[model samples]
Target: RKQRKEAPDDARIRRFEDRISEGKFYLSLSSTKNDPRLMQALRGRLNESAEALGKNVAKDSELRRDVYEKMKALERSLAKAKRMQQEEECFSSKKLHASIVSTESQLRSTRKQASYLTQLAAKTIPRGLHCLALRLSTEYFALNSSRRNIRNEPPKVDDDDDRLLFHYALFSDNVLAAAVVVNSTVTHAKDPWKHVFHVVTDGLNYGSMKMWFLSNPPGRARIDVANVEDLAWLNASYSPVLRQLTSRKTIDYYYYGTHDRGARADPNAKYRNPKYLSIMNHLRFYLPEIFPELDKILFLDDDVVVQKDLTPLWSVDLNGKVVGAVETCGEKFHRFDHYLNFSNPLIAKSFDPRACGWAFGMNVFDLREWRRQNITRIYHRWQELNEERLLWKLGTLPPGLLTFWNRSFALEKSWHVLGLGYDAKTSTRDIERAAVIHYNGNAKPWLEIGIAKFRSYWTKYVDYDQRYLRDCNVT
Candidate 1:
């Protein structure tokens, strides 16, 4: 058995030796040059010879020594060839890796440039479009053309009669938004003629606002339009609160100066339009003085669209509370700190930051009770404190919140659905179910920034066919 095994091993060794000799001749022919195929073949032969010698030469000491010497020589040649090939491969790999890194760097730079251009376009394009729309609307309003009267005269109402009145102090640059509020209110009301709307606006918009209502009156609903300037009792000189609100210092404080280092401190700081802090927004505080004869009234913000009859709000017993408004404690963003600067010690101690806040858009004010509790003084005191020390940063609601803190009654959240203008994540179902939808943020539904889905809720009441709306492309 040993002889038979040795015989096969000896033959294998001889074959490998012949192959190695053939490889050596080929390699020597081009000794200075490298050939991958020639090297691979020689390496294969060396491996075969080593395996054969291990099995066959073990039985013969002399043969084993001679084969081992030949095998060592073959291995040295194979190692040299492999080392040269590896060096070439290493050089090629380095070039490939460098090329990949360079390509990646170029890609990153291109992406950043693209991102910058995209941001620039986003900011400028919308602003340009807004400016153009404003110019067209201004020209449209300038045309002094007579529109067909839908109602001959305002529906007469007895001054002493105890009828439901929806009072709205609408101070807007967009007359379309004001008209839509009236249209939506009367359209959705069960008794359109019985419902009365008291609309107040600024001096500049009075002519266009009155003209629109005269032509497109909402089914005999008593619409009264008054300019804030014409209200003889609403003099700024007489009211310190009004004077402070309209002052340049107050504007700066609310808009840019509220930050730690003012406007320069934070590049992304939020600033309100001076118009948002206007006397019109603060006018709700003086509801008792404005409508002295009226006992209770539902005050609607111009940004709101009434989907359901607000007459039911009259029966919602405020339980002797002066103001009845929807509690906003359910949302984290609606918390006290969102509006009031609690960093100040007076504000920090006065109210609970976690306490439930209320909505001002749809409120039922008990004017008689309001006067009885002297709520206006409380409101004015806070306003004065805010002016003196910057108690709260921006809105009228903060002072309203402080004044009506313990005195106000909490109404149902469904009565007023806020965040339509700002929060895009608000549930569609909740918006549809709400009796009143308020676009309380900068994105009023009349503006292009308003969410497209919510705009339909406000715009459905608009008369797109009207000559004024058509001329300005308001539709």
Candidate 2:
């Protein structure tokens, strides 16, 4: 009975095992048809199966060829992936290198700018501060000089009535300049004694100016130093123009009040000095009234250094005109519009904008003719107009141009050569040939801003060994 049960169980187990094997073979054949690795393996198994089954060899060859193509495609794809990765790395490296170069260039530019700013500050700040301190000291010195009673007797004039008379309204700030002018004039004059110098200074500078002339008198020259306040004719109370000049509004307008407009309009403007509007500067306009005894006067600005004999100036007839000055028509910045505010219709209508302008540094004024034409009244009228409306911004020259417009006789340009102080481009030949070299701008020869090359011309006359100059560090 046991043998019979065991034999039946073993037969059933064998039958189940054969059915499972058949199912696995069909599943593998259907599922692995498209797989490259399995396709390659199946090719070998197919070849053996075909031989066992007695099937066609052509079908086996086709399956093996398809498997070979699939393997080749997979190899090509792997190579392309590697090449793409290398290109990306190369592009990234080049981009990073360009960025570094740009950053370095910017850094170098920043450093250069910083260095330039530092150098600019170093050059300007200390010099500007020194100038400020010097100005304050000068004011105090002038005040002290005014308190002292100093008198300088005028040199005796010979019997000749036709002697050359030179008049200058000098100031304390330009005492050295005045000295140089007188010295140079005397040194170059045909007859030194024939030349007369009438130097009128303000009250503050009267004593010092007189002392300077007395101590260092130009040989045999008639030098008269008088205070502006001492002049009996020039009563400030009588003149509305003079009163307005001392007013707070005019003071502010000239000094630092217009700095905002200047800064916005021109960053490099040279209009920094308040001395342009000083009382001494305006005194020249009162030449006819100042010297009632004189028929003609050769007015010289203190800023000038006489390079040639000024006696020749007296011989040039004014042809009945009040003024004989070098017509600066051909100069770079000597146009009428430069000095006059043509924006006001009154100014625009009153004068020609394109009219030629003349310089005042070396003017030969016919006082007789000036008084006859009433030029002083004309000057006063314009000053009144300016006060009422902002007619012009610059000091004195605008009113002068208007007063002596058609009445001036054009003198030879060689008599006065301007722009030695302001223009660095002024030729050395021009400076040498000039009869009178006028440092007409802000960079006066006495100031540190003056050109070093041109300074020697003015400094040549300065006696640096003098105690006062040495103490003041004028060198």
Candidate 3:
């Protein structure tokens, strides 16, 4: 057979087929196994083409370029496989992380729900139970007081007799009724409390206190102080009225006689009336002696309103400090002329008045420390001398400013805020940040500005017939 001068490529391919039959492909598997099988096949084809170049170099060049392109395509396929595997691993990890976060959120929500329920259960005690408890307590206090009387001595320290005696009187039927109603409303309608809300009002208008209890009832208990003396006597006595005022709620209340007397270490200021602060020289003097263990207590003037939740203020630590009253005018002296006798150290020391802002007119107090330091003498001495700075001698001045400085406790602005009296165009939005709104100054809310920003507070509780507040006609 005349083997025509066939192309060299045809001859090389025929040889390759013969070599594969003799296992040359198996040799590729051993030498280039790590490379893809496709790469091995291309390399074998290139070797065939190179041999063919001996016969035709043009064909060898074309085959080499084709082999390079095929190798690049195979490398791309391997890279894609690696990227797909990596993406799958990343996707699995993210899904696991999301599941963990969801579980944590659920746990947190469950804990808060449990806490709310626990607080709710605590305040669910019946009203009848509280009345019974108070009745029993009253009998106990009367017995103890009688026993002390029979012994020809007053109850002393470490004696439950005196302690229970005070509590029993303070937690009377009227106080309990108010306290019970207040404690019954537990949820904050909007927020929650770690501890119960405690409110103190002069029972001036059940409106302010009542609205507070209604709007923000205690998660735990309520304490009120209401005066019980004859209207005429109440208006006249200082200690009794104060005692009544403090005793309106069972939690903690204090009422002093409007015209009566309290323990007088030194009588400097003659007139001390609850209605007229000018009449009361240093009545807050008795606060510590009466309740010595309290770290702080809020003092509020009657005409105020509580608009939002007060829990934030109650929760503050006060950092073992006293919050001073407001410095309405930037005067160093309460009165300019009062600076003449700045010789008394008390006067000298206080002449540079700390400009403590208005007492938590609605304020928080550090009562235990206040009583420990014996503020009564601090206040009374100021009152004794005729030329004594009358402004310095006043009850509110000494305890409100002097004690705060001596204790070295820092001052914090209270949410317990005072309203800057009335005006024809006063904007309550200005004082919205205030916790307790005091309707201070002569521009009375109930009398003149009947529909002030917080008027609903007063109108809700004032029984026009029974309540005789001054300036009822002003509004």
Candidate 4:
């Protein structure tokens, strides 16, 4: 018999059974060195509410409430823990000290469980998009083979086709969002005829992606959609990431929870985000293989919108660098130390610990330079070393920061402005001047969790008033 898949909440926390013990009971029951004041500080209530909720907290709203309560309760517990540790010789007894250590460990696990649950929900495909995918896929298959449009025509292998085209690479599984990206680019282009878009999606969404573009073709500009899974060069031997993508250990790490104590014991719970494990999220590393013929290409994340003609990016002299992108460190979080492990000498010796990082959502790549410099090999080397996550815990950002360490040219800030997803304080004048805007954080414009203030920037590109979208109630 096949084993049933466990839900995120229970799946992430249950595997940590070895860490939980009767010591939790001891935390609330014990007195700290016979001092009532000290004892009050150490009077920790350890996970009683979650224990009571058990499997009953299954609904999304209930889960949110549980997470909120858990965070509030955890905050109170952290304060109490700090006070107990701060007191002189309080709870210094061996048994009581062990209980404190165990309780802190359990609290860390709770924080991770909460983060995992939130990311699981955030990453889940929304109902409206799922409905759109099914509908478009059904419509695509209903048409005859000749009626299905793959492109304007097979790409001609001629001088005209070889001319410097405004080539773009967008790898995503969201059909509607991909459509918006293409539409926005074409709408804003100074010369749409010179532009070419290359989109890749997982096999499941391939037909849906093709159908959406077929029904709403970008006038003058050509678009080609490829099934990401069918790409020949993405096989195991070529890419370390692809090798891990098929590994049993990797599959279990994402599908079931991890068994690694260090991973489970992580204080930064955001490391548990499922996006870190997604193959599509890391596809940026293999761009040269994806489009070997192109000398230069502009890569766009599905969560971003192009507001101005990007033809000039190809003209921007990379100054012998492999990537041209806007510096993201001005806001203060996208620095090297924030994403990478400086403690590891392997990482520290090669790069600056305090170096500023750049954004990935919209970047110009000098494919020729990338190939000549063999950047892919360096990226693979780092991926191999990080299989056990020794270098960092978060997803592509760290590896991206590493891959182009000293090989990037920073563009003007107005070219690509980020933080539409979670930051509500971005200035209006700054946004108005931005050539491209990125929804980089978790509050995606599609989900209810998206910020209302920033939703307009993304939603404006979406044709929500369309009949099919209306039928799916996508608006």
Candidate 5:
């Protein structure tokens, strides 16, 4: 072959190949053989390798760049493989997490619906109780008081006995509920004869209430039922509650406002019970005036059932305190701010936000002290301040918390265990040992929405086999 002028890049590559053939950096198994045959075989392979390098490695001083490019390509391949493996591993985990989140959302929605429905059911009056009320009222109105002769009459429960007796003032419109209160009290009383109940009810339920307690006389526990409206002095002029009842703003807020404007509805809308508008709910404020003769009285809510002897409550020295109650707040949220609107300048200035709140279900009131402190007057002042509903919307608790703020004597928790109605997790041991178990929430024992476990605690106290209950089919 004719000799060709070699390019400088080609010459450099040739030198590098010659070095490798001489066993310099590159490896070749044929290097050990120094025979002519071996030399000839290597010559053919080296020419082919030199040609391959021309196509792959860039010409001249670009060798370093070529090496780095190859390394980067290898690293990219390794990284791609790792990413694929990770994606495969995480695919199932991602799916499971999304499913769990979806299920939790559904559970929350379902629980909210269930809770709202239960509250509504609790508010409804059952047919059996309605029938019982009607039957009792009919029987009560048909006969005269002389012919009626209701047991536990006036002679034993005269005004003179008020100071000496263990008095309970229960204000309720529900006749059966009132009966249960009296029954439980009388049954649990250490001395039933020493206990006297001043039950005040509205005009609609007056006859029926009087009749039920009369027909089912609570042994020797004297229950004197009276009409709340019949108290002429308790009208819009004297009582602040009655005065609030006459307020056009109060009427609109309770009657016309927040009446179920769906979608725009409040989650706590059910808690704004219309019963708060009733006089009996407010009548609890007027315990001293309701029974002016009584010096000390244990106030009982109709929803409560007496578990232990309440006579000790009468002797619980209030230590100059106007009211004695089980403090509902500790680290929990039942505080002054929870009831009153702290947004109002007047409320914020008047009270401590974290001040402990007390239960009203089972309370001991030193009516003499109440009179001395003018607690009712103070209560009326707060009511008037909140007449426009600035301080609070809920009736019973806010004004009460304000009225009896520092005036309360903290009783032991064992005396009253509450939350049986709404909170399912209320301790069974606490309920059992409780002197009084109160169904303070919407799930009253009388309602269909009542918790089954707690319902029995209330039902066991009730004598369902009684004549009137059996007649009206009140189970």
Candidate 6:
């Protein structure tokens, strides 16, 4: 009994010590009372369970660290992506803002330019035939130069040269009252013929108008002047060319007018005076008489200056072609829209640069063909229609007939460009290329200032006289 008990107590003591180490003293007696093999087996199982728990705890801690690190990385990546997206958005916004600003500036500039042009057109171009004729007369003098050579001579220079000079002279001026006259002046002090330029008053434009047949004044490219009043007559009458055309040809001013009838008793009906239209109409009628051998003739308005020599232009062999007019860059007196109303079986077609706006005021025509085709028939019919519409009112036709010829004519843009009633400044490049300078406005170089390239022409015209600037208001 003592021996068995001693062993049991020793085993019990060992188990107690094990329970103490495990922090569970209550489990020592219970474990010791259980079957020895069973207890031992239970202890073995508990050890295995403890090992599994330790592995599970370690794995859990490792998993937590990995998840935390992964989350932090994802957050940083998201923030970076957001920052990059914001930068792109900001850049896009800036570009859009810039584009809008640029577009607005362009639109404003365009609007301003359009407004200025519109105002000018409405206010300045209403002078009708008196102004029209004046302009034409002035341009004639400006384009044709006085030369020692005879008219029958072969054009010395390229005809285009004269044409270009005309363009430069007409375009160089700043306003209707201020038009430039570009010319070559050879003089003692300087070769005034080399590249002399000056401003010409509209009043003194008679020299250009009759240059086709006029003689130059002594030692000058102009005509002799007695007084300002006789300028127009002297230029038109005292030409060497007039002597040549003695019996067969004649030159005179064509006139047309309408009287008020009792039918349309409205006194205010004359608000838009039809007199201006009459001048063109009368011109159309008298053109045949002035240039009798031909069915068509050229009609030039004043305020044009020629840069190139015109001898070549007259020498151009037109054959059977009708070179009508040049295409204008700015405002057009006879645009397509205006021609639409005049459309008919004879003139229904749209404008063609080859045909319409080709010869312009400076024209070359096939007279025989024009008469055969009844070219003036349309004008006659229109005049009749106008008479029927208002018995008392003056009926006048529009210049839109030029557009009707667009299909049956030839035009040279490089050779001719109308000023469209104002002095439009151009660069030297433009001047070099231009053929005829047409001044379609009232403010001429001799009368006004601030026009490009016109001052030189004005000075040339006035160079001969100490008091040559009588008619013009030079600034």
**Candidate 2: segments with Cα more than 4 A from true spot:** 1-172, 255-272
Model 4 TM-score is: 0.73
What 10-residue stretch in candidate 2 is worst by lDDT? Answer: 53-62
Candidate lDDT values, in order: 0.70, 0.67, 0.40, 0.77, 0.77, 0.38
Over 156-202, each residue of candidate 3 has an lDDT whose tens digit, in order, gives: 33433322211211211222333422332222213332222233223
lDDT of 4: 0.77
lDDT per residue (tens digit) for residues 1-475 in model 1: 4664436535645654665665465455443156766566665666656565664343343265566566666666656665666776787799899999999999988876765453333233244324434554365367566532234344356546755444444445456667777888877887676676777777766665666676566676777776788879886766667887777776666556543334452222233344545677778888878778778887887788988877788788889999999998888777888878888899899889887888888888888899999988888778777765467656677888898988889888888999988788888898989999998765667666668878889878876787655655555
* 193: Cα error in model 5, Å: 1.4
Q: Estimate each model's TM-score.
A: 0.68, 0.66, 0.39, 0.73, 0.77, 0.40
Per-residue lDDT for 1-475 in model 2, tens only?
4665435424533332333343335335433443455445435444443333232333332343344444334334333333444565677689889889999999988876765453343235234324434543454466554544334344355334545344443433346778888888888887776777888776755555666665577787778777778776665675656777677665555555453434433222233234545667787788877777787888888889889888777778788898898888798778899888888898888888889999988888888898898888888888777774378765777888988888989988777889887788888888898899998765677766677889988888878887566555666
For residue 474, model 1's alpha carbon misses the true position, in angstroms, by 1.6
**True-structure lDDT of candidate 2:** 0.67
RMSD (Å) of each candidate, 1 decimal: 9.7, 20.2, 23.9, 22.0, 13.1, 22.9
Stretch of 10 with least lDDT, candidate 1: 260-269
Sort all candidates by TM-score, best to worst. 5, 4, 1, 2, 6, 3
Better by TM-score, candidate 3 or 1:
1
Q: For residue 55, what is the lDDT in candidate 6?
A: 34
Worst 10 residues of 5 by lDDT: 23-32
* Segments in model 1 whose C-alpha atoms lie over 4 Å from true places: 1-157, 164-171, 251-269
lDDT of 5 by residue, 269-347 (tens): 4544668678878888888888787788888999999888988887788889998999988626788877888998998
Least accurate 10 contiguous residues by lDDT in model 4:
14-23
Clashes found in each candidate (C-alpha, N, C closer than 3 A): 0, 0, 52, 0, 0, 81
RMSD of 1: 9.7
